[model samples]
Target chain A: MSSFSTAKPLKKKFTERLKKDFKNHWQMYLLALPVIAYFFIFNYAPMFGIVMAFEKFQIKKGIFGSRFVGFENFHRFFISPFFWRLLRNTLLISIYGLLFSFPLPIIFALCLNEVRNRKFKKVVQTVSYLPYFISVVVVVSILFDFGKANGLITNIATFFGWDGGAVISSAKWFRTLYIGSNLWQHLGYNSIIFISALAAVDPTLYEAARIDGANRWQQTLHVTLPGIASTIIVLLILRLGQIMGVGYEKIILMYGPSTYETGDVIASYVYRTGILDADYSYSTAVNLFNSLVNMVVLFTANFISRKVNETSIW
Target chain B: MMKRSAGEKVFAVFNTIFLLLLCVVFFLPVWHVAMGSISDPLKVAASSGLYLKPLGKPTLGGYRLIMQNSTILRAYGNTLIYVVSSTLFGLVLTILAAYVMSTRGLLFGKTFALFVVFTMIFNGGLVPTFLVVNKLGLIDTRWALIIPGAVSAYNIIIMRTSFSEIPGEMLDAARIDGADEFKILTSIILPVSKAIIAVIVLFYAVQHWNAWFNAAIYLQKSRNLYPLQLTLREIVLQATENSIIADADGQDVMIFRPLIKYATIMISIIPMMIVYPFVQKYFVTGVMIGSVKG
Candidate 1:
């Protein structure tokens, strides 16, 4: 009874302080209202709808009134023939993308750094970012026009012994087209960060290396690489975190039934089933699974990066 | 200047040549499309290589035909409306969020910031988001394009970083003269934030200008509301030439179909090409600002 009497005054004091704070900064709270409401309606509300994943969803019944089905939706996905194919396609496309699209930018930046003519370098850099600004729909359109049976890219491929009828619709060529287009689109834009990082490297380090009789090649290896190493590592860690997030927009634009074998990924599959086919419960369950896996991968990458290099996004 | 060895001289020549060739490769596709758009349509359809020049007498026939298509014109107008409205809407919300987040000693500021940043890492995926939008009756409306994606947390964070860099003394000086939070934000913060604001505006404008997926899914029944990029998709990807060239009779349709695709692409991209060069430096500045916190 004595403890309860003491707790009442403490609780009252806390509320009094909170009320005082609110009075002092009521304008700030007012400024935050729309932003908070926007997130609540768009982001948080959808998160709440993730509950539909466990339900046998019906459009008429809606999310709350839907019957509970436990893990049956998940079971259906796992047992489906598409499960393994989707997983493989997603990993392969991401891994291939990482392998080519990652290092090429760094190399391009390094090469640009060596150019003596500032005007030439500026022009090249400007032109390089142009493709990045092009829409995916147009980029895919370019692919279609250039990858047709008698088109420019196809003719070039035939000279190199490609027996495929058309590059765009071929399952074997889907990953290549996707990753290559990404490289074309992003190589210059992605290198912007590295270019800035290179600029920040101390000029005195290069002077010292030259004073020590180091050649340009030797200087780059000894001085420049070490300067940008942290930026590289941080970007690599960020990249690893998004390894499962090959977006569906470009894939949907590029792929057809013919290329789904090599092109169908988790997000694209979710989009097809959920939006196109209206398989709400099953699609949501599959997507929930994908999200969980992505979160796990991101956390694991961040943890390992922190332990190893003392650098993490958080 | 340092004396160059033979190998160094060779490398210099090779590097310059390589970068020049790379520039050519980068510019070729757009050049190809532009050249193809004006080329004789019959000659283009029969050809099978990269277009070095417009073949068989260059003409503006493609442009004339495309201009006659009401769908393309209406779509262009729709895209402009979306870009301007969304950019203005997004910028105001971003400034508000950035101001609140950058405020020092505000209670729950960190909590509010974390709430925004958490959205960047995890989202509820497509179905739930679609369901929410559907439930709101935004399925076939203009609000579907503008409202749901109006505020990006990434933009908020970038703008917040830029805001936090402003001298707190200026804000404090305004407060001492009986200025409220809104007064300080408008009179002090925003005027000094023109560069970052330009960057954010460009980001939002370009995003809305190029967007089609939302329209593709949301505006299924409302073809009249379709943006330029979505119409471009139907013409280029689905090869639905009939939708755009509905007025053209038989022979004219066959001749102008391929040309119309090229012209539409050129039309959609011209605004970006013209505007980007002027704003390019601002984009670089934005990237630099984003990297400062990242």
Candidate 2:
């Protein structure tokens, strides 16, 4: 009874403190007003509209006025033939990326750390990051040029008496082209995080390894790799979180009707069926499904990271 | 000096060659396109090997065609307007939000941060966002391009991380001098946080400059308001169709289409390439500190 009575004063005191702080920092509140308004209107407003996924949406009826049809849209999506195709393509491309592009950055950072020439290292870094800044349209254009009959790559292949048709048009080559270009564009930029992790490794550990008669390879294995293991794991978990998400913009720009079998992912499917066709309820249902899968995978990865390594992004 | 081991020597040589080769491979494709742009159109079309240089007499015909194209000019203007307005608006919101979140005595700062970060992990996705924009009557307007993507949660988080690093004593000193929160943010905090500001501004600028998806979706009905990337997309589509596949027709059209496409790509990317080196030094520090801490 005494503790319960004391809680009233504590609650009153907390409110009084909050009031004082607000009064003192009214200008801060004013500064934050526009930002708060932006998020509410732009971010939160759409979140509220996610309810449209369950609705039979009509433009005149609006989001709230539309009739709710629980699970019907999801049921429709689940039964659709495109579902398996999009799911397969999205997963395959993401897995291909995970297998290939994920390790290249780590290896690049490790290789860069071993280089003695500072200027040479800087040049390589600069040139490699150049493609990351290029627009998706331009990257696709460059890829098209390379894949074209008389383009550089095609011409080089033809020199070896190989068929030099447009590589992008072939369904079989879509995964290779997409993943290869991604590696080219992002390898250096992604390596920055790992490079920083490498830089943060203790010099004393390297000296100790040298004293122990460990060669460069042994030092890298025992000392350098261990030093960046947590960072690698952290980044790996983050990458796994994005396993369902692919660069739909590049795919949309590059894919033709011929290659749609391999190139169409959930996002591009959403764009086609939702935005292009204006199937609001159906697309929302599809996108909601994508986001849920992403969130579940993300949490699972985080859970595993926390359990195994005691490090996870919360 | 102690003689280096043969194993170390071989490894060093192998590593150098590998890095240099990787650098060349990364650089050569873009370089090839740039050279193709300036090469004589006829020679460019006829060449079978990799384009190492301008194939024959160099001409500015491709560039001249681009300059004379009114659609390209209009797209350039549209892109510039979008980049400037969006960057300014975003930077202001980001800095102000970060400052408030970083404030020492701010009530409910954690709540506000959770509100922001929640959007990063789970959004309403593309359809709902489009519907919201449509209902707001921003659909086909310039605001459609600028308003929706104006404030990114990642940029806000990164900016907040930088702001929190500011010394508490400095803000305390300003408070002691009776300066208002707004005054301190503008006069004191911003001046000290130039590096982060530059980084965030560049982030916003690059985003706006490269954005065509929103334009493709929101302003699909409006061609006059299409950004540079969208215009480039149309140009390339026509060029590819005309040059690569439609070969039985006009030979002269084929000659210049590849050049036109390459020149357009160059023109679109040249501005970013110029600014990239100057800002490259800031990127490592800015990105590392911003992301790794978060």
Candidate 3:
């Protein structure tokens, strides 16, 4: 009885403190209430719905009433012919994108940093970012026009001894078109980070390099590169984290049946089977697998980056 | 100043010329579209190469036709509605979240921050999110576009970083003058944070302006509710031009189809191209602010 009395007083004191805090910050909580509710309904609720991956997931039966199938959906997906194709396409597109898109921005920034004329540099930078603001739908439309048979790009290719027709619909050209367009659209916008990082590089470092008889090329190699090395490393780590997250929006807009051989990715596959085909349980399983892979890759990248360079996103 | 070596001079000249060429390459696609949009429709259809200029006699017939198309007009209106409402809604929620986060020594502040940041790393995939939206009866409704994507955790973090930079003394001064959190936020915090506000507004506005996937998935049954980009997708990508080319005869359809495609592309992108140069610096500022550890 004595122990119970002491515990009751302590609990009462904790409640009193919470009440006082609430009273003081009721308005703040009131402001946060809607934001909290928004995330709950949209984000957290769906996380709970991930359970659908394990169930039959009939629309009529609903998530809870659906029959549980344990890893059957995953097993089916693993054995499906599309398993290897989707995996290969996703990895190849991401790797090719990383190869071309990633370093180009840093190189673009470095080149821009070397310009002596400010107005010309600003104009080039501004014009370059224009495509980044253009809608992906429009970008694809432009691609369709340019990649059609007898179109400008096709004509150019023909002049260079190429006879392939309709580049947009060609499976062989899918990754090239996708990655090339991505480079055109994002090169400037992505380089903005490195550009700012370059701006932050100390001028005295360049001066010191010059004093040490280092020319502009040597200065760029020694002072300029190392100055933005951390930014580059950090951005690289972040980019590595998103290796599995090549977005479905552009892919869906760009891909047709003819090019799906090379164009279809995991996210687009999920959209096709889940939303369009209504294969809810199976698609959810595939998506869950993708998300798990993404998280694992992100953590592994962050871990390796931290170990090697002492720079991590977290 | 020291005289430049021959090698350095050559490098500088080459660098300038290369950047100039890049500018030309970047600007040419838009130029092609614009030129094609104004060209004679039949000429545009027959032509297969880049339109350096209007192929034949320049005409405003394509623009006139596009203006008369009810579907394009309605979709444009819908896009305007989506962009305005989504931006306003997102800005309010972001400001509220950012203000709360920037508050020093607030109870459960760290927990609240982590709650927001956790969504960035992990999210419910497409199927589950769609199911949730469906369960809420938001499918085929405007709310699906506005509500589901209203508060990006990224924008909140950016705004929070900007808000945290505001001098705390100003806030404390207002507090001492019997101002509440809301009042301080409006009177002191907001008045001084216009640059960040412009940045966030631009970010949200452009996002909504360019967005079509949410509309595609949500407004599948409601063609009337389709935004410009979705309509653009149907016409340009899906090649479903019946809605836009309804009254035209067979011959005119062939002629005007390519023109209409180019014209529509130009119309949709013109607003962005026009607004971008003015707001370019703000976006650059936003990027720099985002780069700061938050």
Candidate 4:
């Protein structure tokens, strides 16, 4: 049997690999069957519907039977005044998030890690997490009060002699309010993972750094930061992948027609013109564009991560 | 090797004060909501600043007003039903699926694992999902809320990973004792998997609790079945419209707005926050379980 199979390289390799997979791990296959079937049915199979982006999709004709329209759907969206604005807003918000909001949590976790008072640390951690559980609707409602012209935030701004009226509604302040609230909502939640990663660092590394006469700052820079470096890179890469995928519901809840120029993003636009207006074909086209950009960003990020740090999702 | 210096002590104290202040700011809205719910409605509407204390002699009026609305009560009922049913259904199916996927002896485990993970990375976006849900004839029904979102992809992955951490010897012994896969899963696999199960339940419950968008989109006509979030959202819409109307001063001040808004915020969040501290240890661990490796 070996001699016969060795004469045919492709067949030999296929059968050999297949035999190894089955003989020793047949129980694993049984365990994996339903989940495998689920992803196929639910996730991968839906990729076929991306074709509807090129089609004049109709419920009666279905995704396959619908007539293809070339790039008409994309053309409709790109020429519309909202396209450039949405793209600009999405990238700008994501960039702001990457620059400011992302680091606060890391710094917070580091600070929390350094606190010697365990009881005080626990209390701080508990309070930090409370804001994360508050619903987006509730968060926006509070932002409304803060951003209003006569709101307490406005009142505070007035005390400082800075204009704070209608911060949420104005084109100028929408990004700040959005990103600021985002930081508040996620800072505690985001720090938890970093803290866990911090826990995994070998205490010996800290000891070794200490023997070098390192101060807390020096030790953090030389040891603690480097120890959790991979976790940070992986997280940063994941965040980069989501540049186009900002949380849409919050935007939808907060922004109406008056605020769309500054606050409207890819997801909200899709939700509005696509889902709300029942413009499935055009919406699907726009969404397909979003998915494509997300894929590119994710792959580029993964590639950079693999090259720089040798850590990647793949 | 030196200890934290006096300069560092001052910085630490400042940092502590800053974080505490931020925490207070973070929690003020929640506090306002709780206070507004119990405070005199007129007093709450008229007041400004942080609302640090109960404004006056507490009244049951706001709760009374919210409760008097039968739709709110019905929506609450639907939400509770959805939360309980979905958590139970999701937990059972997830455990079964996780057990199946975690078997080292299973022939197709990695392929299946890859399949589950693929869904997490890439999705059909919303259109195809909506189409599938619609095709299932679940539109505008209570079942739309429960059945369509029965299994969370992330939760399933976590459960599968959790189940894999269980020892191989236990399962081998169960099989040798003539206990079938189903029996082994229930009696042996599940007993050791309590923490993961609790975490997934928390996740699914939160998802169900905050699920206004699905109910908003699906049950557009059925006000009777609208969840509290959607009802609260409708108030947001109404609040916008109401602000357009003039008061006796001929000024649109968004009157009586902050009261129920704060009250709704309290209603939606306070329950979850109260429940959180209890399951917090497991929750902290589970949240990392979702993000770190994910």
Q: Report per-candidate DockQ.
A: 0.77, 0.67, 0.78, 0.45
TM-score of each: 0.97, 0.95, 0.96, 0.91
lDDT of 2 at A48: 89
Across residues B29-147, which tens digit of lDDT does each residue of candidate 4 receive? 77766776677667776766566777887765555445544655676788899889978877876776777667764445566667666766778767776776677688889888886
The per-prediction i-RMS, to one decimal, reads: 1.0, 1.5, 1.1, 2.7
lDDT of 2 by residue, A1-314 (tens): 55987999989999998999889877878888898999998899989888989999987899879999998999999999999999999999999999989999999999889888899888988887888788888888878877776666666656777673767677877888899888888888899999889999999998898889888999999999999999888888888988898856888998989899999999998888898899999998998899889879989999988998898886
lDDT of 4: 0.77
Candidate 3 lDDT by residue in tens digits, A1-314: 45876998888887987788788788888888878887888888888888989998998899889999999999999999999999999999999999999999998998899888899889999998999999999998999999999888878878988777888888988999999999999999999999999999999898888889998889899999999999998888888888988899999999999999999999999999999998999999999999899889888998998998898888
Kindly report which residue pairs in candidate 1 clash with one another. Answer: none
TM-score of chain B of each: 0.97, 0.91, 0.96, 0.88
How many angstroms is the interface RMSD of candidate 1? 1.0
The regions of model 3 sitting more than 4 angstroms off are: A1-17, B247-255
Candidate lDDT scores, in order, read 0.90, 0.85, 0.89, 0.77
Q: Candidate 1 residues A1-314, lDDT tens each?
A: 55987999988988988898798789998999999999988999989888999999998899889999999999999999999999999999999999999999999999999998899889999998888788888888988889989888888888999998888889998999899988998898899999999999999999999999999999889999999988998888889877888898999999999999999999899999999999999999999998888788888988998999897877
Where is model 4 more than 4 Å wrong at Cα? A1-45, A160-164, B1-3, B240-258
For model 3, how does the per-residue alpha-carbon lDDT over B97-208 read when each residue is reduced to its tens digit? 9998898766678989988888888888899999888988998888888878878898899999999988889888888888988888888889999999999999999999
Return the top candidate by TM-score.
1
Please say which candidate is ahead in lDDT: 1 or 2: 1
Q: Give the CA lDDT, 0 to 100, for residue B218 in model 3.
A: 91
Q: Which candidate number has the best DockQ? A: 3
Tell me the alpha-carbon RMSD of every candidate.
2.2, 3.0, 2.6, 4.2
